[model samples]
Target: MAFTIPENLHPDLMPLAWLIGTWRGKGRGEYPNVPGFQFAQEVSFNHDGRAFLNYFSRSWIIDENDEIIRPAASEVGFWRVKENNVLEVLLAHNTGIAEGWVGVVKGAKIQLEMDQGYSSPSAKIVTAGSRLYGLVEGELFTSYDMAAQGQTLQAHLWSSLERQSEN
Candidate 1:
C-alpha cells in the first residue's frame, strides 16, 4: 500500500503518523499473586480526517511454543490533540470497558489519566486513575497510579510491546 497521510492531521499529531499501521507482538503481564501470562497482541491505528486517530486492538493467550490458545478481549479507541496542548484519547473494549483521557504527548511518551469503564463483571463501575507512558529504549512501556479500594497508588499491567512482523 502507498503511504498517504491525511491533510487535516494537526502538526502535533504528525509525529504519531509512523504508528498508524497494524502491529502484532508478544508481551507478558502479571497481577498480584496470580502467575503472569504470555500473550500475543495486535493493534491497528487509522485516521480519517477527524481530529482523532481511530484505534483497534485484540489479544490472545500464547503457550510456551508461541501458539495461540484462546481469544482475549478487544478494544477500540481514538487519539486526538486538545487545544490546551494536551492529547486526548477515547477507548472502549468489547469486554465491557471504555475510557476518555487527556494528557501530554512528549517526543515518544504520553502521560494521561484513565477512567476504566466497566471491565470486570463484578460491579457496574470501579475506580479511576492516572498513568504515564514512555517509549523507553525503543519499546512502549506504561505505569499506573490508580485510586481505588480506599487505597491509592499501585502499579499494574506494565509491559513493553516489541513489534512483531506477523502473528
Candidate 2:
C-alpha cells in the first residue's frame, strides 16, 4: 500500500512518518546463553499529535503449528525526534533492563547507539547495544546488536514486518 505522511504529524517527525503504524511478523532468535526459538512479534509506532512517538513491542514463542507456546518478551519505549535529526529513545524491558539510545535519523533510516543502561541485580548485564531500522519496499526491517553476559557485541534480534495499519 502507498504510504502517505499523516497530516497531523509534527514537522520534526516527518523523517519518521514511515514508522507510524502497526506491524506483525515472525522471526527467529538465537544466542549463546539461551536456546534458539521462533517467535511471533507485533510492534507498533504511534503518536498522539505530540512531539514523540510511543513504541511498544511484544513477542511470543510459537511452535511449528504457529500456535503460541509461551510468552517471550515485551518492551515499552518512547522515540523523541528533534528538528536537527537528533534522536533519543528510552526503553524499559520486562527483563529488568532499561536502555537509553541517542543517535541520528537520516531520511527513512535510523542508527542508534546506547548511551545509558541500567539493570536490576537480577537482570543479565547488558552493557551496550546498537539498533538500526529502515523501511524497504513497504516493509519495516529492524535489527539490533548487544553486549551481554560477558559476550561481545553480536546480532541479538531482527525482524521484517509488513504494515498492518493505514498511513
Candidate 3:
C-alpha cells in the first residue's frame, strides 16, 4: 500500500510515519519461573502534529482457542525522533516500572537498548532490556528481551500485527 505522510507531522518524524496507526495481533510470552502463555495485543501510535508520537499498548492473556482469559499487561509511552535518526522512548508500565530507552532507526527497523529504569517498592526491577521493531512484509513485528528476577536478558515477548487503522 502506498503511504502518504501525514500532512501535519513534524519533519523529524517522517521516518516513523508508517507506524501511525493501530495494530492488532497475537503473541506468546515466557519468562523464568513463569508459565508460558498466549496473548492478544493491540498497539497504537498516534500523534497530534507534534514532534513525538504517543504510544499505548494493552494485552490480554488468551486461552488455547484464542479466547480472552484476562487482561495482562499495559503500557503507555512516547516516541521521539532526534538527530541522526536516534530514537528516544519513555515508557511506564502497569506493573509500576518506568524505563528509558535509546536507539536508532535504520530504514524500516528500530533497535532499542534500555538505558535506565525505576521500579516502585513493590515492583520487580529490570536490570536490562532490548526491543526490536520492524516493518516486515507490511506487518509490524516486535520482539522484546528483558532481564529481571535474577535472570539474564532473554526473549520475553514477540508479536506480528497488521495495521488496523490510519489513526
Q: Each model's TM-score?
A: 0.74, 0.94, 0.98
Candidate RMSDs in order: 4.0, 1.4, 0.9
The runs of at least 3 residues in candidate 2 whose Cα sits more than 4 Å from the true structure, single-residue gaps closed, are none
Best by lDDT: 3
Score residue 87 of candidate 3 by CA lDDT.
99
Off by over 4 Å in 1: 1-12, 115-124, 130-133, 136-139, 142-153, 162-167
Candidate 1 per-residue lDDT, tens place, 30-120, comes to 5455487877877777777666788787889889998999997577988887665588888776756567777877666778887444556
Global lDDT of model 2: 0.88
Cα distance off (Å), candidate 1, residue 86: 0.6
2 or 3: which has the higher TM-score? 3
Q: For every model in order, what is the number of clashing pairs?
A: 0, 0, 0
Candidate 2, residues 54-132, lDDT tens digits: the string is: 9999999999887999998899999998768999999999999999999999988999999999999999989889999
Tell me the deviation in Å of residue 163 in model 1: 4.8
Best by TM-score: 3
Residue 133 accuracy (lDDT) in model 2: 91
